[model samples]
Target: MSGLRERKKERTRQALSDIAVALFLEKGFDAVSVAEVAAAAEVSKPTLFRYFPAKEDLVLHRFADHEDEPARVVAAAREAGAVPLDALRDHVLAGLERRDPVTGLNDDPRVLAFLRLLYGTPALVARMHAYQGRSEELLADALGGADPLAARLAAAQVVAVLRVLAEENVRRITAGERVEEVLPGAVAATRRAFAGLGEGLSSFC
Candidate 1:
């Protein structure tokens, strides 16, 4: 089932990613070059290329699975006669309770540093914008292909609010606020953000 070539490739990819994150924290992401990452990971340039198509892949790969989360939440709720907004709101709140990183629940110093790295690096920000577009596309498709207008509008609003909430969480975290201290604000802010869609979400709540 598992070929030697594939297994070795996976190992090399992980090694490179591990080394890259460490270097990124130690020296800044923009300052680190592919060559340095390869050397630091004990991998050749071509080998690194085979593993990660580009330098951005190192950080982005971690976010790949999360790209589908919004869509998955919507789809799951639809089968139960729930609107997309209701579905997504429930998913967000549930994630908060679980202290999921995607919900910004674990915004400790290391996580805040990672957020700073993404914000400070121009290329990473550009890639992140691209990823946001993909997330919208996924949600739109999940919301029934009949009318894209509704899906697009809902996805845009939901994502905008979610991003703002996440940013605020990181802000509080960086300012030395604990998770418990920041949660009430986060919850209230989230409710306010979803207030316009009260009919659908209130029923779910």
Candidate 2:
């Protein structure tokens, strides 16, 4: 029953997010209101708030699944007796190979639309910084070393590198470059970014 309830709740949450995103895309993010989204999803405003505390969350929830991905990659690498930086590098390369939206290497129209929506919204952009901060903290914990400051600094650098790499990919794609045309450059940039990190953090964590 507990599991069933959680699944039902997840469905409701997804439904609300879907409705909210459709409405936002149709109109605009700032033009849409939380109350309107609640009405469209057929849920009470309070209930919608229960699932997403803020209006920005309706869109940002799309990223919730990957919020801890970096940390998970590090943890899994440690368990497999692999270098965390190498594992992270491979993980990102795999994402690019598969055109993952998180990697900003996907050219799917739906994904492009969503990225436009996310990047064009000031509120969403501001909220994303909070997400990045959390990712760095989780990665720092995963690094787990005697010098907490070093772990935190390393995590920050890693997170910033990944973020910048993804942003560059997005910039090229949004500026009319095809994903195929950008693939080689994106992969090379990712390698260079990780190589820079490896110089200092190869043995880290």
Candidate 3:
């Protein structure tokens, strides 16, 4: 019974998000109302708020599953007795191979359209920055009980690399490059970026 309730709730949440995105894309984010989204999804406004507390969340909730991905990778690496940097690198490589949506290498038309919506909308962009800030905090915590400043610095660099890579992938795809054509360069850039992070700033003046 509990499991069935959870599945039903998941369906409701997904339906709200799907309908919200469709409407936002059809009109514009600012032009659409939360009440309209609730109406389209056949849920009460309160029910929609139960799942997404803010208007931005209607679209950004898609990223909720990945909010702590980097932190999870660091924790898993620690458990495996491996370096977190290498773990993150391998994760990016695997994601690239799979053309993961978060990696921005996915060529699906809908995904492209969604990315377009996210980048084009200032409110969504601001909200995404806030989400990344939270992600940084999670990653810093996962970096272990080190100097707090050091962990924060490392997390900042790591997250910056990821943001740059993802943005570049989106840019290339939106510019009409196929995923297959962009894959090689993406892999190479990610490897170099991670290598720089793993090596640290010892050689710098």
lDDT tens digits, residues 49-149, model 3? 99999999999989988889999998998888887888889999999999898998988998999999998899998999889999999998998563788
Model 2 Cα lDDT, one tens digit per residue, 117-138: 9888899989988889999999
Best by TM-score: 2
lDDT of 3: 0.89
Candidate 2 colliding pairs:
none
Pairs with steric clashes in candidate 1: none
Of the two candidates 1 and 2, the one with more favorable TM-score, higher being better, is 2
Clashes of each: 0, 0, 0
By lDDT rank, best first, the candidates go 2, 3, 1
lDDT by residue (tens digit), candidate 1, 1-205:
5698888877767767778988998999888999999898877889888888889878776677888788888887877877667667667787777767666667666766777776668898788778778887887777655567877766666666777777777777767788899888888777777776555333322
Winning model by lDDT? 2
lDDT of all the models against the reference?
Answer: 0.75, 0.92, 0.89
| Per-model TM-score on C-alpha atoms | 0.84, 0.98, 0.93
Give the winner by TM-score: 2 or 3.
Answer: 2
Superior candidate under lDDT, 2 versus 3: 2
Model 2: lDDT equals 0.92
Q: Please list all clashing residue pairs in model 3, or write none if there are none.
A: none
